[model samples]
Target: MNFALGFKTTMGESGSMEALEKQLICPICLEMFTKPVVILPCQHNLCRKCASDVFQASNPLWQTRGSTTVSTGGRFRCPSCRHEVVLDRHGVFGLQRNLLVENIIDIYKQESKRPLQPKAEQQQLMCEEHEEEKINIYCLTCETPTCSMCKVFGAHKNCEVAPLQTIYNRQKTELGDGIAILVAGNDRVQAVISQMEDVCRTIEVRITEVHLPKAQL
Candidate 1:
């Protein structure tokens, strides 16, 4: 089935707000629509910045600074509907309530066809373009963490070597869920340690009080 039909079918299960959003998205940006600017005359809508960029690319003369005239700006047409829409009279707004509806519909479809984690893990591992030094060890090819000697003499030759820290940061961003899980675990550990410290302090105080009373008696 087409995306529109599937979108509608999934949206039927969602609330009213979702149904309105499915039509509001800019075809370029797959995410929620932003700065929705409607084309004049045709009444079709596109993201403001996206539409301008499209127009500029379509007409090379539009890019030259101070070279454009009033007529030059009006000559550009909408790429999608091929309709004439002038930028001067049009206004931009951040009306994203309709965009949210489409997101909800898409999210529902993705949830319904959830991928099996175990099955995904069973798939073959893809090879990285960077030269392989060892089983999993990477050959940086002297571009980053790897040294010049390693690039020339070692298994790592001229290859696209990225910094280890950069790789680590990207992985962290991608595995945000894993980071949340780790944070929760660390919090639990801290709570347990705090409780144990309190218990130890109470035990020491009780011992001191009991011993002094017994010695005096």
Candidate 2:
């Protein structure tokens, strides 16, 4: 089962936290998976709504005349691996719900809501050549972190330098904007999932009232 983590910037081991958060995001929606997540036959997990969207786009006439049944029997490609997913009469609902992944999302949400604990001061990154100096500047020309000594007389002496704090703040803003876009995409996928859930409910009721009783006879 595929799972993605949703993370907010906080103090302590920033690099590891960022990498962990990236793993939790859905490849299709590029956001945390919404409820009713499903696992494909190929073993990848996608938000049910996102999967439904992919299916509908591939088979435009699948929902024609309000019918859930696919007459011609077509398949949709997986967004990540591009593996073909064959559709049954129930379509997306036929795929299994990934209980493990859903539970992880629930746990992540609970943890994220809690207040962050105070962390110890992080160690400064040191320059290779001038081990005594902390890296405080970014060499724009070489696109690498450097110390003041490097800027003054080392390899980056001719390169333009910017304060590391300035670059950090800019990157933080860009990450925030990216998260916003992903959230917006998730909202759209949620709507599609809702529609598919309604369709599945209708199909289940029909089966119970019509097919089951006739079979018992």
Candidate 3:
């Protein structure tokens, strides 16, 4: 049986969104897998960013200026099973994307947006790939929130994604700390500016004193 078919069969029997969502989580981040999820030789999935971070940790000398673009090939162990994943010169970018998981994430997000209702109000959603069959499992979106603005138009049209979990929180926290550092530096700059203004004032006073009229020729 095909991998997707087998999974779908299991999903049908389990009929639990919570259980399905649990599998979508990345082991390293412990959050839902973000875009461009990669599959290791061990068959475990990871977000590309997480994979790059792990790869860099394993090969710090190859890390560039905060980007995953690597100059040489290296290897990193899968966080799930510790299976070594060898990379080419392209680094994590060279890894094959798990498109099946990406598609599943899209479906998961769509299901998350719809409100739960009685069977009478419930509408069946058919998968684009498997149009003949209604989407497996019942909708249990009451616990999840939906955003109307996400699908409207403009820049947010393609803005659909699982709520920022692992990467976003970490980046935001790092950003908050960075803001504090910038604020402290700005305080030093303001003090320097005040001192410069004081020097100008003293220079003006010295010039006035030198210009004072004297009895001597």
Candidate 4:
């Protein structure tokens, strides 16, 4: 009898932990929510880009009569729960995106405490051609850093090359686009959240109206 009682208690504890895990998990990834957003109808939440990325990655490739290559587009399904979400519904997609963005920003603000370090300080790559110099400039075609001498060589003869700084800036811009996407998603969610608050107020007023009549009776 004692064993049985202990088993039930352990099971109960496990169940509670599972519930907490579900709350933290990303709806899109079915893992911890990286960037969380609340969805409509069910009000279930998910990571913002996770859902959209899943949709884009899995779309149908039905090419009509003449097309040689197939094109895929996003599906309107929640990433975590696999629930069908109607993207066309006014404010729904925007709200979910906003929530995710806000969560990501909050997380970023917390992590920003770690100061940025310079790459050159960390990497110690020496140019093979010029034994004395660090090969910071990269050849585009050869796809390798060359000291001034290697820059004139075989594969890099006509290829375009640039200093590490230029490459860093270009890569940063590309990464910035991804960050911008998250920010945009967050903005949409914020707009809907304001609307949701208004909705809550309306419901409260209606509830009071219903209660007052009963109190009078």
Per-model TM-score, in order, reads 0.29, 0.48, 0.46, 0.31
Task: Report the lDDT tens digits of candidate 3 across residue range 1-217.
Answer: 7764554445542246678889899888899999999998899999999998999899887755566554678998888888888888778888999998998888776665655434544565554434454433221233222333322432234444344244457669999999999999999999999999999999998888788888531
lDDT of 1 by residue, 37-134 (tens): 44435655666677666666655554433533523342456555777655432222222223434454465556445443354544433333334432
Please give me the total number of clashing residue pairs in predicted model 1. 2
Alpha-carbon RMSD to native, per candidate: 21.9, 26.7, 20.9, 28.7
Stretches of candidate 2 off by over 4 Å are 1-17, 64-72, 121-217
Instruction: For model 2, name the residue pairs that clash.
Output: 4-24, 4-25, 5-24
Candidate 3 accuracy as lDDT: 0.72
What are the per-residue Cα lDDT tens digits for candidate 4 across 98-176? Answer: 4544454454343334344455656777876568777777787777667656667644667788996688788899999
- Give all candidates' CA lDDT scores: 0.54, 0.81, 0.72, 0.59
**Model 1 TM-score relative to the real fold:** 0.29
User: In model 4, how large is the Cα lDDT of residue 14?
Assistant: 38
Ranking by lDDT: 2, 3, 4, 1
Cα-based RMSD of candidate 2: 26.7
Candidate 1: worst-modelled 10 consecutive residues by lDDT: 89-98
True-vs-predicted CA distance for residue 142, candidate 4, Å: 6.2
